[model samples]
Target: MESAELRELLTPEGVALLDSLPPYTSSTDVLKIVAGLRKDGYSASLVATVLTQAKLRGKAVAKFGDFAQRMLFTEAGLEQATRLPVAALHAGRYVRAGLTSVADLGCGIGADALAFAGAGLQVHAVDADEVTAAITTYNLSPFPEARVSHGKAEDTDLSDVKSVYLDPARRTSGHTNTNRLANAEDYSPSLDFAFGLAEKLPTGIKLGPGFDRDLIPDTCEAQWISVNGDVVEVGLWFGPLKRDGITRAALVMNAEGLHELTAATDSTDAEVGELGLFLYEPDGAVIRARLIGDLARSIGAHMLDEHIAYMSSDVAVSTPFASTFEVVHEFALDVKVLAKELKSRGIGTLEIKKRGVDIDPAEFRKRLSLSGKNSATLFLTRLGERRVAILAQRL
Candidate 1:
């Protein structure tokens, strides 16, 4: 069929087909009709445009469509949601701390709100988009005392809220739309403004994971969260959740089922020395919180250098802050010498890790004639202004 016909078919019949089909993952799948028409030799763009309009209309009426797109078209929605840890890694902490109610401002598709409600907290979820608001209502239907409303966060009365969750819009456009009303600053919504609005109540604001440490305010506690070793989001905590320190790094993992790897300024600070034989790199969350010194002390390790994130140790033990690796072999520098050393050891494959070296890993491997059978981690670094490489394995 032609594109126009295909677009028209999606109005009711197409939606039924979609509902009947197995659940689609990406929101962009809602536009698959254009692709289907194109495969049948129809005008793709024309059909896509019509279908797009119809899809928006359907979303506005029924409150369901591309959630990320709806939020992105308005402002920075995509950037915020993807950057924040939406999987609710810290929900258990929130619940155990006695935070019984949450007002999820700009609750997008109600991902975090649903997590909170499922954790047995009453949720007052709000979104500016009418479609998103309606979707939140439907998405949150199973939760007890979960209420969804349509309005801008600034306009919503929050007197009943004891814990506030903010995931501000951060992307300027959809993949197609380019108009933007605000920049990163606008997406931030001002720490002062957040404190004033949340005032005395616990508040959590989700921010870009890569945001600079300087941007975090002194009054709030900053936490960098990592899930399964990926640095997912940075959370700013206010009121009772705030820690009395510079930053707190939390490595929350599902390993051993579900367990949190928490280390902060209070627990990590120690009188450790310089990097030793065994090198440890703490999780991204711990690094973000600047708890390297504390982590070193906790694990009885020391910093290799002032600039490097690696913590050195002569002994190895399983620790939450860092991954422990064993050093089984050593190689002296001079690319030619290193090549000869590896050859004598019958070593070939290499995993190169760097800290202060300017050497490209590929080039280093090529220079060392690295290619054969054994796999080893090559650490490139500077010890008292001298270039060196350490060969190590998991301890």
Candidate 2:
């Protein structure tokens, strides 16, 4: 949004009109609302800006939950903002360390700043984008301890703040449509600057989960975090923020609660063996953290393929680090034979998992012509030197 549109949207009349409107939805008749607002004499800019916010709020629920209702967002800012639950964890690290204040550098939409403030830590949120900073100022108005400002992260003075958190802009400049910056050096604050902050104070840097491990500084603790089953971000913690005795960590948060796998270094790969009675699918976070060897040893499982992430064992074990499945059938990788077998077993609903192979599951499913009441997981992979299919049931 332009500064003028934002200026108008912050007016009492604008806010009231937004609040008074019915809940925005996918089916919302935006054209009708625009026509009605124009007839009511509201300025075109105000109407357009408010409507955009309403649509954003509807989509923001996935990230902000109930807080999205009162919050304002620029599309790019909201897209880059951390999920509330994850941001709360970041804030908790500061609270647990007994830090009273934090400076949020490149604080998109003030999501982390909100968490820090909610956790009772005084926060200064800085964003380079004028409109995003304004939106953050509005989002954080509820907390007097939280301050928002428009400024470049590299220029921000951090004399008073006890700790710093940086999530550099990994996308191109814009409030709406923007392209992702693939190179870490191209990040708004730059990786060198973000990493260099550790020398001055306790710091935490949030980067993409798939960040190059080789690029990670060995001096700090690197942690990959997953929500549900998706690996989200890797956090680099320095100084007092870094936990003792932990250099690498895979943190999985789901309905099963929080599960962590930590190691001093990437664990060595487990010894490969024959296909066992069960197959184990390592969680994405675990794979990203390279602790698959540690996880395999814990569950008495071995690598199904030396080069693959899949593991298997005769022992049936329960662990949050990996999903367990009971192997039901092993057959040739031929599609025609598999279809005939599946049809004979009355298997209908199927989940296809592939590794170390090239095949599209969607296209493969159509050829199966499946019809049954039962559901099964089909694994397409190599068992030693041969390519094979393993039909299994999730445990």
Model 1 ranges with Cα > 4 A deviation? 1-16, 22-90, 128-138, 175-184, 243-247, 257-275, 329-348, 359-369
lDDT digits (tens) for residues 232-265 of candidate 2: 8999999888899889999999997999999999
Query: How high a TM-score does candidate 2 get?
Result: 0.94
The TM-score, computed over Cα atoms with residue i paired to residue i, of candidate 1 is 0.71
Cα-based lDDT at residue 253, candidate 2: 91
Per-model TM values vs. the true structure: 0.71, 0.94
RMSD of each: 6.9, 1.8
Regions more than 4 Å wrong, model 2: none
Highest TM-score scorer: 2
**Would you give me the overall lDDT of model 2?**
0.92
